[model samples]
Target: MKLKMYFLLLALGALTLAFQSCDDDDNDGISVPAELQNALAEKHGNAQRIEWETKGTYYVADFYEDNYEKEAWFTKDGVWQMTETDIPGLAALPAVVKSAFESGRYASWHVDDIDKLERKDVETVYVIEVEQGKQEMDLYYSESGIFIKEVADTDGGHNSEGYLPSDLSAAVRTFINENYPDARIVEMDVEKEMTEVDIIHENKAKELLFTPDGTWVSTSWDVRTSDLPGAVTAAVQARYPDYVIDDADYVETKENDYYWVEAERGEEEVHVKVTAEGVIL
Candidate 1:
Protein backbone atom coordinates (compact mmCIF):
# COMPACT_ATOMS: atom_id res chain seq x y z
CA MET A 1 0.00 0.00 0.00
CA LYS A 2 2.86 2.43 0.75
CA LEU A 3 4.51 1.72 -2.63
CA LYS A 4 1.22 2.32 -4.48
CA MET A 5 0.69 5.68 -2.73
CA TYR A 6 4.21 6.85 -3.66
CA PHE A 7 3.66 6.00 -7.35
CA LEU A 8 0.32 7.86 -7.38
CA LEU A 9 1.99 11.00 -5.96
CA LEU A 10 4.71 10.89 -8.62
CA ALA A 11 2.10 10.66 -11.42
CA LEU A 12 0.23 13.63 -10.05
CA GLY A 13 3.43 15.70 -10.08
CA ALA A 14 4.04 14.91 -13.74
CA LEU A 15 0.47 15.77 -14.63
CA THR A 16 0.78 19.16 -12.94
CA LEU A 17 3.94 19.94 -14.93
CA ALA A 18 2.20 19.00 -18.21
CA PHE A 19 -0.68 21.36 -17.43
CA GLN A 20 1.73 24.17 -16.62
CA SER A 21 3.58 23.67 -19.89
CA CYS A 22 0.31 23.97 -21.81
CA ASP A 23 -0.59 27.17 -20.00
CA ASP A 24 2.71 28.65 -21.12
CA ASP A 25 2.10 27.69 -24.76
CA ASP A 26 -1.44 29.11 -24.96
CA ASN A 27 -0.47 31.54 -27.72
CA ASP A 28 -1.49 29.27 -30.58
CA GLY A 29 1.67 27.12 -30.35
CA ILE A 30 3.81 29.97 -31.72
CA SER A 31 6.57 31.90 -29.98
CA VAL A 32 6.44 35.70 -30.12
CA PRO A 33 9.66 37.52 -30.97
CA ALA A 34 11.30 39.51 -28.18
CA GLU A 35 11.48 42.60 -30.38
CA LEU A 36 7.76 42.53 -31.06
CA GLN A 37 6.98 42.12 -27.36
CA ASN A 38 9.13 45.13 -26.54
CA ALA A 39 7.59 47.19 -29.32
CA LEU A 40 4.08 46.42 -28.13
CA ALA A 41 5.02 47.38 -24.57
CA GLU A 42 6.44 50.67 -25.76
CA LYS A 43 3.49 51.64 -27.96
CA HIS A 44 0.67 50.44 -25.73
CA GLY A 45 2.09 50.86 -22.26
CA ASN A 46 -1.06 49.69 -20.56
CA ALA A 47 -1.85 46.77 -22.86
CA GLN A 48 -2.96 43.69 -20.95
CA ARG A 49 -3.92 40.09 -21.59
CA ILE A 50 -1.86 40.05 -24.76
CA GLU A 51 -1.88 37.04 -27.08
CA TRP A 52 0.55 37.12 -29.94
CA GLU A 53 0.28 35.33 -33.30
CA THR A 54 1.81 35.49 -36.73
CA LYS A 55 -0.52 37.13 -39.25
CA GLY A 56 0.95 36.73 -42.75
CA THR A 57 4.17 38.76 -42.75
CA TYR A 58 3.32 40.70 -39.60
CA TYR A 59 3.13 39.97 -35.91
CA VAL A 60 -0.34 40.63 -34.50
CA ALA A 61 -1.06 41.25 -30.85
CA ASP A 62 -4.57 40.93 -29.53
CA PHE A 63 -4.96 42.65 -26.19
CA TYR A 64 -7.06 45.01 -24.12
CA GLU A 65 -6.50 48.69 -23.36
CA ASP A 66 -8.61 50.66 -20.90
CA ASN A 67 -11.01 47.73 -20.81
CA TYR A 68 -11.52 47.88 -24.57
CA GLU A 69 -10.37 45.16 -26.98
CA LYS A 70 -7.64 46.13 -29.44
CA GLU A 71 -5.42 44.52 -32.07
CA ALA A 72 -2.04 45.89 -33.07
CA TRP A 73 0.05 44.81 -36.04
CA PHE A 74 3.82 45.08 -36.34
CA THR A 75 6.40 44.32 -38.99
CA LYS A 76 8.84 41.46 -38.53
CA ASP A 77 11.42 44.09 -37.53
CA GLY A 78 9.04 45.37 -34.83
CA VAL A 79 7.86 48.53 -36.56
CA TRP A 80 4.25 49.32 -35.70
CA GLN A 81 1.95 49.03 -38.71
CA MET A 82 -1.63 49.62 -37.53
CA THR A 83 -3.97 49.34 -34.60
CA GLU A 84 -7.70 48.68 -34.51
CA THR A 85 -9.93 49.26 -31.50
CA ASP A 86 -13.53 48.33 -30.90
CA ILE A 87 -15.71 51.38 -30.54
CA PRO A 88 -18.48 50.72 -28.00
CA GLY A 89 -21.27 52.33 -30.01
CA LEU A 90 -22.20 55.17 -32.35
CA ALA A 91 -22.34 57.51 -29.37
CA ALA A 92 -18.61 57.03 -28.81
CA LEU A 93 -17.85 58.21 -32.37
CA PRO A 94 -16.76 61.74 -33.09
CA ALA A 95 -19.67 64.16 -33.51
CA VAL A 96 -18.78 64.91 -37.12
CA VAL A 97 -18.37 61.25 -38.03
CA LYS A 98 -21.60 60.26 -36.31
CA SER A 99 -23.54 63.01 -38.02
CA ALA A 100 -22.21 62.02 -41.41
CA PHE A 101 -23.38 58.46 -40.92
CA GLU A 102 -26.82 59.58 -39.78
CA SER A 103 -27.29 61.69 -42.92
CA GLY A 104 -25.33 59.66 -45.49
CA ARG A 105 -26.76 57.39 -48.17
CA TYR A 106 -26.72 54.25 -46.01
CA ALA A 107 -28.33 55.94 -43.04
CA SER A 108 -31.18 53.47 -42.89
CA TRP A 109 -29.01 50.36 -42.93
CA HIS A 110 -28.63 48.38 -39.70
CA VAL A 111 -25.26 49.05 -38.12
CA ASP A 112 -23.68 45.81 -36.92
CA ASP A 113 -20.31 47.02 -35.59
CA ILE A 114 -17.86 49.90 -35.52
CA ASP A 115 -14.07 50.12 -35.19
CA LYS A 116 -11.46 52.87 -35.05
CA LEU A 117 -8.39 52.31 -37.24
CA GLU A 118 -5.09 54.08 -36.65
CA ARG A 119 -2.22 53.52 -39.02
CA LYS A 120 1.21 55.06 -39.20
CA ASP A 121 1.53 58.04 -41.54
CA VAL A 122 -2.16 58.11 -42.41
CA GLU A 123 -5.28 59.84 -41.19
CA THR A 124 -7.38 58.02 -38.62
CA VAL A 125 -10.47 56.28 -40.04
CA TYR A 126 -13.72 55.03 -38.61
CA VAL A 127 -15.09 51.77 -40.02
CA ILE A 128 -18.79 51.10 -39.64
CA GLU A 129 -20.27 47.73 -40.61
CA VAL A 130 -23.85 47.76 -41.78
CA GLU A 131 -26.16 45.08 -43.13
CA GLN A 132 -29.44 45.07 -45.03
CA GLY A 133 -31.33 41.98 -46.03
CA LYS A 134 -28.62 39.65 -47.34
CA GLN A 135 -26.13 42.37 -48.21
CA GLU A 136 -23.40 43.66 -45.89
CA MET A 137 -20.85 46.41 -46.35
CA ASP A 138 -18.08 48.20 -44.48
CA LEU A 139 -17.89 51.97 -44.83
CA TYR A 140 -14.74 53.94 -44.19
CA TYR A 141 -14.87 57.58 -43.10
CA SER A 142 -12.17 60.06 -42.28
CA GLU A 143 -11.95 61.70 -38.90
CA SER A 144 -13.23 64.93 -40.42
CA GLY A 145 -16.42 63.12 -41.52
CA ILE A 146 -15.58 62.78 -45.21
CA PHE A 147 -16.85 59.56 -46.71
CA ILE A 148 -13.94 57.47 -47.94
CA LYS A 149 -14.97 54.16 -49.51
CA GLU A 150 -17.19 51.17 -49.03
CA VAL A 151 -16.39 47.50 -49.62
CA ALA A 152 -18.54 44.45 -49.53
CA ASP A 153 -17.97 42.52 -46.30
CA THR A 154 -16.62 39.30 -47.67
CA ASP A 155 -14.51 37.17 -45.36
CA GLY A 156 -15.14 39.86 -42.72
CA GLY A 157 -12.52 42.30 -44.08
CA HIS A 158 -10.87 43.89 -47.10
CA ASN A 159 -7.85 42.67 -48.97
CA SER A 160 -4.59 44.47 -48.30
CA GLU A 161 -3.53 44.24 -51.94
CA GLY A 162 -6.46 46.05 -53.49
CA TYR A 163 -6.77 46.49 -57.26
CA LEU A 164 -3.55 47.62 -58.90
CA PRO A 165 -3.29 50.67 -61.14
CA SER A 166 -2.55 48.45 -64.11
CA ASP A 167 -6.04 47.00 -63.67
CA LEU A 168 -7.66 50.39 -64.39
CA SER A 169 -9.29 51.15 -67.73
CA ALA A 170 -7.62 53.54 -70.14
CA ALA A 171 -10.43 56.06 -69.87
CA VAL A 172 -10.28 56.05 -66.08
CA ARG A 173 -6.52 56.62 -66.13
CA THR A 174 -6.87 59.43 -68.64
CA PHE A 175 -9.51 61.19 -66.61
CA ILE A 176 -7.42 61.11 -63.44
CA ASN A 177 -4.25 62.25 -65.20
CA GLU A 178 -6.04 65.10 -66.89
CA ASN A 179 -7.95 66.32 -63.84
CA TYR A 180 -5.65 65.52 -60.93
CA PRO A 181 -2.25 66.02 -62.51
CA ASP A 182 -0.37 65.75 -59.24
CA ALA A 183 -2.36 62.90 -57.77
CA ARG A 184 -0.95 59.40 -57.21
CA ILE A 185 -3.29 56.47 -57.14
CA VAL A 186 -2.98 54.47 -53.94
CA GLU A 187 -5.90 52.03 -54.02
CA MET A 188 -8.70 50.97 -56.31
CA ASP A 189 -11.96 49.03 -55.98
CA VAL A 190 -14.34 47.96 -58.72
CA GLU A 191 -18.01 47.38 -58.02
CA LYS A 192 -21.01 46.54 -60.14
CA GLU A 193 -22.24 50.07 -60.68
CA MET A 194 -19.02 52.07 -60.29
CA THR A 195 -15.27 51.92 -59.71
CA GLU A 196 -13.63 53.72 -56.80
CA VAL A 197 -10.10 54.99 -56.63
CA ASP A 198 -8.22 56.46 -53.68
CA ILE A 199 -5.49 58.95 -54.41
CA ILE A 200 -3.07 61.28 -52.71
CA HIS A 201 -2.95 64.80 -54.11
CA GLU A 202 -1.12 67.79 -52.71
CA ASN A 203 -0.47 65.78 -49.53
CA LYS A 204 -4.20 65.13 -49.02
CA ALA A 205 -6.21 61.94 -49.49
CA LYS A 206 -9.07 61.96 -51.98
CA GLU A 207 -11.60 59.46 -53.30
CA LEU A 208 -12.79 59.45 -56.91
CA LEU A 209 -15.73 57.57 -58.34
CA PHE A 210 -16.31 56.45 -61.92
CA THR A 211 -19.10 54.67 -63.67
CA PRO A 212 -18.54 51.19 -65.07
CA ASP A 213 -17.95 52.70 -68.51
CA GLY A 214 -15.24 55.01 -67.05
CA THR A 215 -17.36 58.16 -66.89
CA TRP A 216 -16.34 60.41 -64.00
CA VAL A 217 -18.90 60.48 -61.21
CA SER A 218 -17.47 62.55 -58.36
CA THR A 219 -14.42 63.30 -56.29
CA SER A 220 -14.48 64.02 -52.56
CA TRP A 221 -11.99 64.98 -49.88
CA ASP A 222 -12.02 66.31 -46.36
CA VAL A 223 -12.10 70.05 -45.83
CA ARG A 224 -11.44 71.90 -42.63
CA THR A 225 -14.38 73.79 -41.17
CA SER A 226 -12.38 77.04 -41.20
CA ASP A 227 -11.39 76.54 -44.83
CA LEU A 228 -14.99 76.36 -46.08
CA PRO A 229 -16.03 78.94 -48.69
CA GLY A 230 -17.14 82.23 -47.21
CA ALA A 231 -20.61 82.00 -48.71
CA VAL A 232 -21.08 78.40 -47.60
CA THR A 233 -19.98 79.17 -44.04
CA ALA A 234 -22.17 82.25 -43.91
CA ALA A 235 -25.22 80.39 -45.08
CA VAL A 236 -24.72 77.65 -42.49
CA GLN A 237 -24.32 80.18 -39.71
CA ALA A 238 -27.35 82.10 -40.85
CA ARG A 239 -29.52 79.03 -41.01
CA TYR A 240 -28.38 77.29 -37.84
CA PRO A 241 -27.05 79.89 -35.46
CA ASP A 242 -26.93 77.46 -32.55
CA TYR A 243 -24.79 74.90 -34.44
CA VAL A 244 -21.05 75.09 -34.93
CA ILE A 245 -19.42 73.69 -38.05
CA ASP A 246 -17.21 70.82 -36.96
CA ASP A 247 -16.08 69.33 -40.26
CA ALA A 248 -16.82 69.48 -43.97
CA ASP A 249 -16.30 67.63 -47.24
CA TYR A 250 -15.82 69.28 -50.59
CA VAL A 251 -17.40 67.09 -53.28
CA GLU A 252 -16.84 67.80 -56.98
CA THR A 253 -19.31 66.04 -59.23
CA LYS A 254 -19.70 65.98 -62.97
CA GLU A 255 -22.46 68.57 -62.90
CA ASN A 256 -21.86 70.57 -59.72
CA ASP A 257 -19.72 70.91 -56.61
CA TYR A 258 -20.93 71.27 -53.05
CA TYR A 259 -19.83 71.20 -49.43
CA TRP A 260 -21.22 68.68 -46.98
CA VAL A 261 -20.84 70.26 -43.56
CA GLU A 262 -21.38 68.63 -40.19
CA ALA A 263 -22.68 70.92 -37.49
CA GLU A 264 -23.15 70.24 -33.83
CA ARG A 265 -24.60 71.87 -30.67
CA GLY A 266 -24.32 70.05 -27.37
CA GLU A 267 -25.61 66.59 -28.33
CA GLU A 268 -27.54 67.77 -31.36
CA GLU A 269 -26.04 67.03 -34.79
CA VAL A 270 -26.92 68.07 -38.34
CA HIS A 271 -25.51 67.74 -41.86
CA VAL A 272 -25.94 70.66 -44.24
CA LYS A 273 -25.32 70.51 -47.97
CA VAL A 274 -24.58 73.84 -49.61
CA THR A 275 -23.28 74.86 -53.01
CA ALA A 276 -20.28 77.11 -53.44
CA GLU A 277 -22.65 80.05 -54.02
CA GLY A 278 -24.35 79.31 -50.66
CA VAL A 279 -27.45 77.69 -52.11
CA ILE A 280 -28.77 75.16 -49.59
CA LEU A 281 -29.62 71.76 -51.12
Candidate 2:
Protein backbone atom coordinates (compact mmCIF):
# COMPACT_ATOMS: atom_id res chain seq x y z
CA MET A 1 0.00 0.00 0.00
CA LYS A 2 2.82 2.43 0.91
CA LEU A 3 4.66 1.67 -2.34
CA LYS A 4 1.49 2.28 -4.45
CA MET A 5 0.83 5.60 -2.65
CA TYR A 6 4.40 6.72 -3.23
CA PHE A 7 4.15 5.95 -6.98
CA LEU A 8 0.80 7.78 -7.33
CA LEU A 9 2.15 10.86 -5.52
CA LEU A 10 5.21 10.88 -7.81
CA ALA A 11 3.03 10.70 -10.93
CA LEU A 12 0.83 13.56 -9.68
CA GLY A 13 3.86 15.71 -9.03
CA ALA A 14 5.17 15.11 -12.55
CA LEU A 15 1.83 16.02 -14.06
CA THR A 16 1.64 19.24 -12.05
CA LEU A 17 5.16 20.20 -13.12
CA ALA A 18 4.31 19.60 -16.80
CA PHE A 19 1.16 21.77 -16.56
CA GLN A 20 3.14 24.56 -14.88
CA SER A 21 5.78 24.47 -17.63
CA CYS A 22 3.08 24.68 -20.32
CA ASP A 23 1.44 27.65 -18.60
CA ASP A 24 4.75 29.44 -18.38
CA ASP A 25 5.49 28.82 -22.04
CA ASP A 26 2.07 30.10 -23.16
CA ASN A 27 2.35 33.26 -21.07
CA ASP A 28 5.87 34.08 -22.18
CA GLY A 29 5.66 33.26 -25.88
CA ILE A 30 1.99 33.77 -26.91
CA SER A 31 1.11 36.85 -24.87
CA VAL A 32 0.59 39.96 -27.01
CA PRO A 33 3.63 42.20 -27.31
CA ALA A 34 3.43 45.81 -26.11
CA GLU A 35 4.45 47.39 -29.41
CA LEU A 36 2.09 45.25 -31.52
CA GLN A 37 -0.77 45.85 -29.12
CA ASN A 38 -0.24 49.58 -29.38
CA ALA A 39 -0.32 49.33 -33.19
CA LEU A 40 -3.51 47.27 -33.15
CA ALA A 41 -5.16 49.77 -30.83
CA GLU A 42 -4.17 52.60 -33.12
CA LYS A 43 -5.53 50.84 -36.18
CA HIS A 44 -8.88 50.05 -34.54
CA GLY A 45 -9.54 53.00 -32.30
CA ASN A 46 -13.20 52.03 -31.90
CA ALA A 47 -12.42 48.58 -30.61
CA GLN A 48 -13.20 48.26 -26.90
CA ARG A 49 -11.83 44.74 -26.54
CA ILE A 50 -10.33 41.96 -28.67
CA GLU A 51 -11.20 38.28 -28.42
CA TRP A 52 -8.85 35.84 -30.06
CA GLU A 53 -9.83 32.63 -31.87
CA THR A 54 -7.89 29.94 -33.70
CA LYS A 55 -9.19 29.57 -37.23
CA GLY A 56 -6.98 26.85 -38.78
CA THR A 57 -3.60 28.39 -39.67
CA TYR A 58 -4.65 31.94 -38.62
CA TYR A 59 -5.59 33.66 -35.41
CA VAL A 60 -8.65 35.92 -35.72
CA ALA A 61 -8.93 38.91 -33.44
CA ASP A 62 -12.61 39.78 -33.19
CA PHE A 63 -12.98 43.48 -32.46
CA TYR A 64 -15.96 43.74 -30.16
CA GLU A 65 -18.11 46.81 -29.75
CA ASP A 66 -19.12 46.93 -26.06
CA ASN A 67 -18.48 43.17 -26.03
CA TYR A 68 -21.69 42.43 -27.91
CA GLU A 69 -20.87 41.45 -31.48
CA LYS A 70 -17.70 40.80 -33.48
CA GLU A 71 -16.93 43.60 -35.93
CA ALA A 72 -13.58 43.13 -37.69
CA TRP A 73 -10.41 41.13 -37.78
CA PHE A 74 -6.61 41.61 -37.49
CA THR A 75 -4.10 38.97 -38.44
CA LYS A 76 -1.89 37.43 -35.81
CA ASP A 77 0.95 39.63 -37.13
CA GLY A 78 -1.31 42.72 -36.92
CA VAL A 79 -2.13 43.22 -40.59
CA TRP A 80 -5.37 43.89 -42.57
CA GLN A 81 -7.10 46.13 -40.05
CA MET A 82 -10.56 47.36 -40.98
CA THR A 83 -11.65 51.00 -41.02
CA GLU A 84 -15.03 52.65 -41.59
CA THR A 85 -16.17 53.73 -45.08
CA ASP A 86 -19.47 53.82 -47.07
CA ILE A 87 -18.61 52.40 -50.48
CA PRO A 88 -21.81 51.16 -52.10
CA GLY A 89 -21.39 47.44 -52.79
CA LEU A 90 -18.30 46.16 -51.00
CA ALA A 91 -18.73 46.56 -47.29
CA ALA A 92 -15.17 45.40 -46.75
CA LEU A 93 -13.47 48.61 -47.91
CA PRO A 94 -12.17 50.96 -45.24
CA ALA A 95 -13.78 54.36 -44.73
CA VAL A 96 -11.13 55.98 -46.90
CA VAL A 97 -11.80 53.50 -49.73
CA LYS A 98 -15.53 53.96 -49.25
CA SER A 99 -15.06 57.69 -49.57
CA ALA A 100 -13.29 57.04 -52.85
CA PHE A 101 -16.22 55.06 -54.29
CA GLU A 102 -18.80 57.60 -53.12
CA SER A 103 -16.79 60.49 -54.54
CA GLY A 104 -16.72 58.66 -57.88
CA ARG A 105 -20.55 58.41 -57.99
CA TYR A 106 -20.07 54.65 -57.91
CA ALA A 107 -22.55 54.00 -55.14
CA SER A 108 -25.45 53.81 -57.56
CA TRP A 109 -23.35 51.75 -59.95
CA HIS A 110 -23.93 48.02 -59.98
CA VAL A 111 -21.32 45.29 -60.20
CA ASP A 112 -21.02 41.51 -60.04
CA ASP A 113 -17.37 41.28 -58.97
CA ILE A 114 -14.04 43.13 -59.12
CA ASP A 115 -10.50 42.11 -60.01
CA LYS A 116 -7.02 43.61 -59.60
CA LEU A 117 -4.75 42.98 -62.59
CA GLU A 118 -1.01 42.88 -63.26
CA ARG A 119 -0.32 45.46 -65.95
CA LYS A 120 1.51 48.77 -65.75
CA ASP A 121 3.13 51.45 -67.90
CA VAL A 122 4.17 53.95 -65.19
CA GLU A 123 4.17 54.41 -61.43
CA THR A 124 1.25 56.77 -61.80
CA VAL A 125 -1.07 54.00 -62.96
CA TYR A 126 -2.77 51.70 -60.44
CA VAL A 127 -5.33 48.91 -60.74
CA ILE A 128 -8.67 48.93 -58.89
CA GLU A 129 -11.17 46.10 -58.68
CA VAL A 130 -14.73 47.19 -59.28
CA GLU A 131 -18.03 45.29 -59.47
CA GLN A 132 -21.08 47.26 -60.55
CA GLY A 133 -24.35 45.23 -60.47
CA LYS A 134 -24.11 42.28 -62.87
CA GLN A 135 -20.81 43.37 -64.43
CA GLU A 136 -17.38 42.96 -62.92
CA MET A 137 -14.48 45.25 -63.93
CA ASP A 138 -10.93 46.47 -63.35
CA LEU A 139 -10.67 50.24 -63.04
CA TYR A 140 -7.22 51.75 -63.23
CA TYR A 141 -5.90 54.91 -61.62
CA SER A 142 -2.79 57.06 -61.51
CA GLU A 143 -0.63 58.05 -58.54
CA SER A 144 -2.37 61.43 -58.46
CA GLY A 145 -5.76 59.68 -57.99
CA ILE A 146 -6.71 60.19 -61.61
CA PHE A 147 -8.81 57.60 -63.47
CA ILE A 148 -6.76 55.75 -66.09
CA LYS A 149 -8.77 52.95 -67.65
CA GLU A 150 -11.54 50.39 -67.41
CA VAL A 151 -9.15 47.68 -68.48
CA ALA A 152 -11.36 44.62 -69.01
CA ASP A 153 -14.17 42.46 -67.67
CA THR A 154 -14.73 38.86 -68.63
CA ASP A 155 -17.46 36.23 -68.37
CA GLY A 156 -15.21 34.45 -65.93
CA GLY A 157 -15.62 35.32 -62.26
CA HIS A 158 -12.40 37.37 -62.32
CA ASN A 159 -13.18 41.04 -62.92
CA SER A 160 -10.85 42.76 -60.49
CA GLU A 161 -7.88 44.97 -61.33
CA GLY A 162 -5.21 44.02 -58.79
CA TYR A 163 -4.40 47.41 -57.23
CA LEU A 164 -4.38 47.78 -53.47
CA PRO A 165 -6.81 49.89 -51.48
CA SER A 166 -4.48 52.87 -51.91
CA ASP A 167 -5.52 52.93 -55.59
CA LEU A 168 -9.13 53.94 -56.36
CA SER A 169 -11.08 56.57 -58.33
CA ALA A 170 -12.84 59.49 -56.59
CA ALA A 171 -14.63 61.42 -59.29
CA VAL A 172 -15.78 61.59 -62.94
CA ARG A 173 -13.59 64.62 -63.55
CA THR A 174 -10.59 62.71 -62.31
CA PHE A 175 -11.46 59.84 -64.68
CA ILE A 176 -11.92 62.21 -67.64
CA ASN A 177 -8.82 64.29 -66.95
CA GLU A 178 -6.58 61.23 -66.90
CA ASN A 179 -8.12 59.33 -69.81
CA TYR A 180 -9.82 61.71 -72.26
CA PRO A 181 -8.78 65.38 -72.54
CA ASP A 182 -10.38 66.61 -75.76
CA ALA A 183 -13.60 64.66 -75.21
CA ARG A 184 -16.54 66.49 -73.65
CA ILE A 185 -19.53 64.53 -72.43
CA VAL A 186 -22.80 66.35 -73.07
CA GLU A 187 -25.40 63.81 -72.00
CA MET A 188 -25.76 60.64 -69.94
CA ASP A 189 -29.44 59.79 -69.98
CA VAL A 190 -30.13 56.39 -68.46
CA GLU A 191 -33.48 56.27 -70.19
CA LYS A 192 -32.06 57.35 -73.52
CA GLU A 193 -30.59 54.88 -76.00
CA MET A 194 -26.95 55.99 -75.86
CA THR A 195 -24.26 57.95 -74.01
CA GLU A 196 -22.88 60.78 -76.17
CA VAL A 197 -19.39 62.24 -76.11
CA ASP A 198 -18.22 65.17 -78.27
CA ILE A 199 -14.78 65.70 -79.73
CA ILE A 200 -15.00 69.41 -80.42
CA HIS A 201 -12.19 70.28 -82.89
CA GLU A 202 -12.20 66.81 -84.39
CA ASN A 203 -15.78 67.14 -85.64
CA LYS A 204 -16.65 63.78 -84.17
CA ALA A 205 -19.41 62.53 -81.87
CA LYS A 206 -19.39 59.09 -80.31
CA GLU A 207 -22.35 57.33 -78.76
CA LEU A 208 -21.72 54.28 -76.63
CA LEU A 209 -24.48 51.88 -75.71
CA PHE A 210 -24.30 50.71 -72.11
CA THR A 211 -25.68 47.60 -70.48
CA PRO A 212 -27.54 47.79 -67.20
CA ASP A 213 -24.30 46.59 -65.63
CA GLY A 214 -22.54 49.72 -66.94
CA THR A 215 -20.81 47.76 -69.68
CA TRP A 216 -20.25 49.50 -73.02
CA VAL A 217 -21.92 47.19 -75.53
CA SER A 218 -21.53 49.20 -78.74
CA THR A 219 -19.76 52.37 -79.84
CA SER A 220 -21.14 54.42 -82.78
CA TRP A 221 -19.30 57.44 -84.11
CA ASP A 222 -20.46 60.36 -86.30
CA VAL A 223 -17.73 61.95 -88.40
CA ARG A 224 -18.31 64.96 -90.69
CA THR A 225 -17.72 63.04 -93.94
CA SER A 226 -17.08 59.37 -93.34
CA ASP A 227 -19.20 58.10 -96.25
CA LEU A 228 -21.72 56.94 -93.65
CA PRO A 229 -25.42 56.71 -94.35
CA GLY A 230 -26.30 59.73 -92.14
CA ALA A 231 -27.46 62.85 -94.10
CA VAL A 232 -26.31 65.49 -91.57
CA THR A 233 -22.65 64.74 -92.39
CA ALA A 234 -22.96 65.95 -96.02
CA ALA A 235 -24.93 69.13 -95.22
CA VAL A 236 -22.66 70.53 -92.44
CA GLN A 237 -19.28 70.13 -94.26
CA ALA A 238 -20.58 71.96 -97.35
CA ARG A 239 -21.84 74.93 -95.31
CA TYR A 240 -18.99 75.43 -92.82
CA PRO A 241 -15.52 74.44 -94.05
CA ASP A 242 -13.53 77.15 -92.24
CA TYR A 243 -15.73 77.48 -89.14
CA VAL A 244 -14.30 74.36 -87.49
CA ILE A 245 -16.69 71.71 -86.25
CA ASP A 246 -16.91 71.56 -82.49
CA ASP A 247 -19.66 68.98 -81.84
CA ALA A 248 -21.88 66.88 -84.12
CA ASP A 249 -24.42 64.02 -83.60
CA TYR A 250 -27.29 62.52 -85.57
CA VAL A 251 -30.93 61.81 -84.64
CA GLU A 252 -32.81 59.10 -86.50
CA THR A 253 -36.09 60.01 -88.17
CA LYS A 254 -38.79 58.20 -90.15
CA GLU A 255 -37.49 59.64 -93.43
CA ASN A 256 -33.69 59.76 -92.73
CA ASP A 257 -30.98 60.74 -90.24
CA TYR A 258 -30.15 64.36 -89.19
CA TYR A 259 -26.77 65.75 -88.02
CA TRP A 260 -26.26 68.76 -85.77
CA VAL A 261 -22.99 70.66 -85.39
CA GLU A 262 -21.85 73.27 -82.87
CA ALA A 263 -18.62 75.34 -82.79
CA GLU A 264 -17.16 77.42 -79.99
CA ARG A 265 -16.33 80.91 -81.20
CA GLY A 266 -14.89 83.49 -78.66
CA GLU A 267 -17.86 83.34 -76.28
CA GLU A 268 -20.73 82.06 -78.42
CA GLU A 269 -20.99 78.88 -80.46
CA VAL A 270 -22.25 78.39 -84.02
CA HIS A 271 -24.89 75.68 -84.34
CA VAL A 272 -25.87 74.05 -87.66
CA LYS A 273 -27.94 71.06 -88.73
CA VAL A 274 -27.76 69.12 -92.00
CA THR A 275 -30.49 66.88 -93.44
CA ALA A 276 -29.83 63.32 -94.63
CA GLU A 277 -29.44 64.48 -98.24
CA GLY A 278 -26.51 66.62 -99.45
CA VAL A 279 -28.42 69.78 -98.47
CA ILE A 280 -27.25 72.86 -96.43
CA LEU A 281 -30.04 72.31 -93.88
Q: Which candidate comes out best when scored by lDDT?
A: 1
The ten-residue window of minimal lDDT in model 1 covers 157-166
Candidate 1 per-residue lDDT, tens place, 1-281, comes to 99999999999999999999998778444677789889999999999888888877778888999988988888899988778888988999999999989988799999998988777645577889998998899887777786776778877654432221226789988998899997666556676778988877775779899998999999998887878889999999999999999989999987789999999999999999999999999
Residue pairs clashing in model 1 are: none
lDDT string, candidate 2, 44-157, tens digits? 566664555444433444454443333233446665433211123445434444455557645566544432222221132233455665666655433334343344556554
RMSD of each: 9.7, 16.4
The global Cα lDDT (0 to 1) of model 2 is: 0.46
**lDDT (CA) for every model shown?**
0.83, 0.46
Q: Specify the poorest-scoring 10-residue window by lDDT in model 2.
A: 159-168
**Which number leads on TM-score?**
1
- Assess the local accuracy of residue 233 in candidate 2 as a C-alpha lDDT between 0 and 100: 49
